[model samples]
Target: MIRTLTEKEIEISGEKKIYGTLARPASAYTDEKFPAVLMISGSGPLDRNGNGPKGKYQLNVYKELAEYITKLGFITFRYDKRGTGKSEGDWISTGMWDLVDDAELAFKFLQNHPQVDRDKIIVAGHSEGTIIGTALSERQELNGLMLLSGGVGNLHEFTTYQRMLTYQELKNSKGIKGLLMRLLINEEKAETKTQKQTKKIIESNKDVYKILFFFKQPAKWIREHFAYNPRVGLKKVTYPVIAIHGDKDGLVDPSLLEELSSLVKGPSETHIIKDMEHGFRFQYEQKSMVNVKKMLKVLPSRPLNPDSLGVIESWLTKYFKADVSSDIKENA
Candidate 1:
C-alpha cells in the first residue's frame, strides 16, 4: 500500500517557499534503517509529482519510480522546485546554485528522519535536476547519486543545438523560412539572444533584427548559466554515481551527458537508452504538451526495457549493502 506522508516546506536560497512529499514505505518501519533517495525534478516550475505548466505525461514520473524503488526496498523523498506548484518563488529569476541548495533541503530533512539510515542517502536527479544534484554530490555526505537525462555540454554548445532544432520547427511551417534563416544564421548579432528569446519571435511582433541585435550584448540569464558548468563541478564528487540518457533527447545534447560520463573519472556508470528522449519517452515528439507528458511519464530504468533501470537500481542496492565502488566504469 502506498502510504501518504506528512508534507513539508522550506525557504530556498532566494526565499522561495518550496514544498515536498515523503513516500514512506511500509517496510521502512521494520527493516534495517533504509537507504533514502531525494528525488529532484528537472527545470521549470515542476511539482513533486512531475506536473508543471511546461509540458504532457502527468503521471508523476518521479513518484512512480519511488513506488517501484521503495518496493525494491528503498525509501524516497521528492519535492517541487522553487516558484512552481505549491511552492512560492520566481522561476525565471533563479540560478543553478539556488536549485542545488533547494534540493539538498529534502536530503537534510530525510537525514533527520528516524526511519532513514544516517549513512545512506541517495540523490536521484532527472534532467536539469541531474545537473544540480551531480554538482552537489561533491559537497554533501551522500551515499550515491543517480543522474538521468542530464545536460552536460557547455551552455554555448547546448544552446546552439537547441536553437537549430527550434529554428528547424519554424522553418517547417513558415513560408519565409529562407529569410528567417538568413536573419539567424549569417548574422553575428543573433549570437547573443538566449534560445527562449529567439523562440518568442514566433509569437511576438518584434523584428528579426531586434532579436538578433539583443544577442550582440548577451543576457544576464545566459551569463548565469555559462559560468555554471555541471560536468566541471561534478568532477569533484567522490560518491558512487549512476547516470543514463535517452538516445532521442530533443532538448539537451546527447553528447553532453556522454561527455560527463567521460569526464567524471571516478565512480560513475553511464547508460544510453536506444530509443528514449530527454523525458525518457521511447519515441518523443518535442512540443510544449509533449514535453509535459514526457516529464510526467515514469523513466523505467531503461525505456521500453524495464528489466534494466540501467545500473541505477543495482548501484543503490549494492551501495546500501556497503560495497560502494570508488572506481568508475562506463557501460554500454
Candidate 2:
C-alpha cells in the first residue's frame, strides 16, 4: 500500500515556507529509520512533486522513484522549491548559487528528521537539480547523489543552446526569445548609448553586467554561452553519483552522459534510457507538447519518465546500499 507519509512547511533562509513531503512504505514505522533522499528541482520554481508553477509531473517522478525506493527499503523527502507553489519568492530573483544552497539546506533539514537514517541521505536532482545535487554532495554529509538529465556542459552554454534550439524553430515568427535575449544582452544597452543608462534601465541587474564584463562583450554573452563549459562544476563533484540520461532527450547533448561519469572522481554509474525526454516522457514526435498533454491526462497522480522510472529506482538502491563510514575513503 502507498502510505501518504508526513510533511511540514518550513521557513528557511528567506521569506519562503518550503513545502516538503516525506514518503515511505506503508509498512514503515517510527522505529524504522530508513534511508531517505532529499529531492531538489531544477532551474525553475517547481512544486513538491517536481511540477512547474502548480503541476505534478515532478511529484509523480519523485513519488514513483520514491515508491520504488520504498519498496526497495528506503524513504524520500521531496519539497517545493522556494518561490513556487506553497513556497514564497519570485523565480526571477534567485540564481544558481541560491538554488544550490537550498538543496544543501534540505539536506540539513532531512538530517534532523526522526524517520530518516541520519547517515543514509541521498540527494536526487533532475536537470538543474543535478548541478545543485553535485554541489551539496561535495560537502561530505550526503550519502550520494542521483543526477537525472544532469548537464555536463557549462550553464552559460546550455542556456544559449536551449534558447537557440527554441528560437530556431520560431525564428521566422517574431522570435521572442531572441528579442528577449537581445534586450538582456545588447540592443537595449546599445540603444541607451552608455553603461550608466544601460545599468539603470536594463532590468537584468548588475550580475549580468559582471558576467558581461567578464567577456568584455556584454553583447557577446551568447558566444560565452554557446561555448559554456560545465566541466568546472562536473569536475568538482566527488561523491557517490549516478547520472541518468534519456535517449529521447532533445534538450541536452546525450553524448555527454558517459563523459560525466568519467569525470566524477568517486563511485559512479550512468544509465542511458532508450526513449525518454527532458520530462521523462516517452518519445512521441519532435517538439510536441502532446507528451505533456498525455501526461496531464493521467490526472491527479503523475509520473516522470513513465518508461524509465525503474532505472532511477534501481540505481538509487545500489547507491544507498554502499557501506557507510566516515573513515571510509571519500572517493569510492
Candidate 3:
C-alpha cells in the first residue's frame, strides 16, 4: 500500500532563517530515521515550490518530484534560497556562490534532522541547481547526486548557445524586430557603438527590450554565473551521479549528458528523456515559437514526465537502501 506522507514547515538558521519543508511517510515512527533527499530548485527567482514569477510558466517541477520521492519512502527537504520565497535577502545582490552557501546550509540542516539518516543524504538538483548540488557533493559525503537538465559546458558557452538558439527561433518565426535587436545587442562591436545601439533600442522599445533581454536578471548574479564552470564542480564530485536531460530541451543541449557522465569519478549514468522539454514535461511536438507559447500557457496544467521520475526512482532505489523496517536500511 502507498503510505501517506506528512510535511512540516521548518527553518534552517543561517545568514538568514531559511524556510523549508520536510516530508516523510506518515507512518514513520518517532524513533525511525529515513533516507533523505534534498531537492534544489533551478535558477532565477524560483521559490521552494519551484515556481518563478517570471513569464506565465507555473511548472512546480521540484515540488512534484519531492512529492513523488516521498511516496517511495524517502524523507525530502526543499527550501527557498536566501533571496527567494520566504527566505531573507536581496535577490539582486545574490550571486552563484551565495546561493551555493545557502544550499550547503540546507544540506547540513537536513543532515541534522531527527528523522533523517545523515549518511543516506542524496542531493538532487534541477537546471542551475545541478551546479549547486555538484559543489555540495564535493564538500560533503553524499550518498548520491542527481542532475536534471544541467549543462555540460561552461556557463559562458551555454549562455552563448542559448542566445544563438533564441536568435534562430526568432528568425524562423519571422520575428525581424527581435532578431535585429538580438544581433545589435550581442554583436562584438565597439563598446561605444554597442552602448549607443543599446541605449537607442531601450529608448525606442523600452518594454520589449526589457522583457526580452533584461527581465528579472541581476547583473552580479549573471556575471558570476557566466564565470563559473559547472564541470569543475562535477569533476570534484566523487559520489555516484546520474545526469538526466530532456531530448527537446532548448535551453541546454542534451549532448552535454555524455560530457557530464564522463567527468564523474564514481559510478555515473545518463539518460535522455524523449519528448520531454526543459521543464521535464512531455512535449511530442518539435520546437516552434507558437508551440513554445502554447506550452507556456498550459504549464499550470502540465504533468511531470513519468519516465524521468521512473529513472530517478530506480536509480535511488538501486544506489541507496531505504530503511524499510527499522525506519531505514542501507541498500546492500
* Model 3: ten consecutive residues of lowest lDDT: 202-211
lDDT of each: 0.62, 0.59, 0.75
- Give a tens-digit lDDT track for model 1, residues 226-292: 5677777677667677777766666666666566556665577778776665655454444422243
Better of 2 and 3 by lDDT: 3
Best by TM-score: 3
Instruction: Estimate candidate 1's alpha-carbon lDDT, on a 0 to 1 scale.
Output: 0.62
The list of candidate 2 runs beyond 4 A from truth reads 1-15, 54-60, 164-230, 287-307, 322-332
Provide TM-scores for the models. Answer: 0.71, 0.69, 0.83
Residue 298, candidate 2: Cα error in Å is 8.9
Q: Cα miss at 87, model 1 (Å)? A: 1.7
Q: Which candidate do you rate higher for TM-score, 1 or 3?
A: 3
lDDT of 2 by residue, 288-325 (tens): 22234554454333235544667765666566652232
TM-score of 1: 0.71
Give one digit per residue, the lDDT tens place, for model 3 in 207-245: 123435555435456556666777887777677888888
> Given candidate 3, what's the lDDT at residue 244?
87
